[model samples]
Target: MFSIASDSAKSVRYVLEHDHADPNESIGPQSALAFALTNEHLTQKLEIVKALLAHGADPASLRNPELNPPHRDSSVGDDSMLLSPPPTTTLEAMDPATRYFISRADAPQTRHLSTLLQKSLFRPLGGVRYDIVGQDQVFEQLFTVLNLHSRTLSVSPLVILLCGPSGHGKSFLARRFGPLLGVPTHTVNVTTLRSTHDLWDSYSMSPYEEITTRTLAQFLLENEGKRCVVVLDEIEKVEEPKVLYSLLMPWELGERVAGTCSPRAGHRHIDVRQVVWLGTSNIGHDFVFEFCETSSGMSVSHGEYLELARLVRPRVSQSLGASLSSRVTTVLPFVPFTEAELMAIATEAFYSLGGERAYFVSLDIVEHVSRKAIECYIPEEGARSLHRAISSLLMDMPEFLEQSNK
Candidate 1:
């Protein structure tokens, strides 16, 4: 009976006490202790958990007996200890498992929220550590922004603009840390977005006019009151002034409408203003050349970028809505990927598949293949070319063939 009840009972206790606990774990009638542990209130649930732990519950036991709370044959009147000292004192004498269970029950809500965030979001973000290195000031600024936004119980959104060249790991950093901070991410491919209409027509309409319409806004609404990190990738692709203006409007004020088109007939608008938006761009070799032609540095000059952004604000307002382009602040640069960084990313990928041997094979073959791909293709290319090059390298590898044969 003890064996049968233990598995379900432990699972029930876990779900009620642990922040990451899945409420769906299986339980049965024979596991009366498990069934009792499902009480919603923390106080009631913890009492049951305490009772089980105090009664010498073995945490390792999994199998449940057909009968639990096994009926005792002897009389209980001889045992007077139960009516004496309280279980509170008895609780102090138990193992860590018991202590941990009790302590978790008493833990504050913030700790529970942290645990839940870690389990659901951070765990899946590849556990990548932030590389502060030369960017201590930058990291401090980012952290300050994140903390400010997190402390907001209402709608105080903080926009973190990561401006650097391509391949600098901007997206990687955002993806990795966004979830852990309880901030949801929705990336916008700036290159793909040519016109105000382009953003609207591409994605489907469900919670909004179109799927892409205010993508960040929709994600924020879904996870209301939570910090949100919106990544606008490759914004340099949006050379048009109108598009740039539209993108910035949302960050300035409280709300910015992306469109006005609904299923009923007319246009539908996507209102998303209270979100932290990060825009990234890589303008090739002509960074200073193009921007200087107008008024700023191709990538680094904030003043020039802002001026250019302001010039195109009207197009977005006219097409989307005057209300849409009213909110935008800050234009950050995307750093280019250095040879060493690219190599590091490749090495990381190899180790992720396995380790040691796998890493060696992938690095050796992938580097050779990637170099050859660039040599065979045009001087300037994009992600598609890179993907093809990698695919070609994997296909040509002798080790890959051997593995497939096995």
Candidate 2:
């Protein structure tokens, strides 16, 4: 409510984006939407409305018929929202965007809001994050696959198999994949799933065998028709290779295949198209390192990356089978980090642990910690070992001790 009165678009965006203030929230006598509607004279009012709508402010709620009646909300006295929006200041008197949610007979069938959000939200290739560190070749190939996927028109889910050495940054990149495109990412560790059809588990209820969804299914259904990223981390760890068959429909046809739990075929398919499916595996770890050694260059060229990616195909096929492997749009080789990158990563990780006390710590502190921490890091284990390295360094620091020695 303060945001609407403050008449600042930035504040509205901050409250919506950071505080997650619900736009339709009813407080006392006024709704957030009602307050914003009354303040039509505010300079940034329209932008505030846009921000609210984008963050899930419902337009239909503003079209309440009883709100305009003379005897409306009378018991609320001076605090009533009816006291604010003057009869002359209706939605028609407001901006076009204000009237957009209330579609009258002559209103266009298609709205710009729908088309605006339909397109994928990724920045161009050059704008990809650099914080991921030492996976330039991987990023290049990753964006190349996304460009081809073009979520705007594609019906099938785009699958990109991320296969390379462990701990380098495959999982790290997977976690950030959704945020990079301004969308939600749902990650499932393949090892944790108990059954083959765990992705969309169903159960017979009320003897009717009605289909009810949970977890990943609910996540997909909630995001139906929208672009999202789903990363199956450590997919090769699944006990049964056949577990992947459950995903074949959504991965290749954009539909969720109902399992035996559902006896009915009518509700079988939950439209999960427009998902960019990521599967991370270490199946091609050895080959990625071997290629780096044979090429013997400062950087792996795009062509070389492509060649290495091709090598990953057979690795995936042998491990996960050819049908699923064939559906993969591309297999990106997550290259092992270079020596400099390893230490650089270690140094970054080192400083992050120090808190404010780190400012007092000297250059040798990082060098000292890095050498010991780096010993635990290996190509196969990747950056996963860095945490242990940091723990070892902390053990020697008096400040980090269980009881500090003052």
Top-scoring candidate (lDDT) = 2
Give lDDT for model 1: 0.40
lDDT tens digits, residue span 126-232, model 2:
22233355676776566555554665455667888888887777777776677646676677778776676675542211121124434567668778878887888
**Candidate 1 TM-score over all chains jointly:** 0.40
Q: In the order shown, what is each candidate's alpha-carbon RMSD?
A: 16.9, 17.3
Candidate 2, superposed: residue stretches over 4 Å from native: 1-120, 124-128, 202-213, 258-264, 397-406
**Shift in Å, residue 26, candidate 1:** 30
Candidate 1 runs further than 4 Å off: 1-141, 148-157, 174-178, 191-226, 247-249, 257-273, 284-343, 352-406
Q: Compare the candidates by TM-score and give the number of the best one.
A: 2
Q: How far in Å is the alpha carbon of 122 misplaced in model 1?
A: 11
Q: Find the 10 residues in a row with the least total lDDT in model 1.
A: 126-135
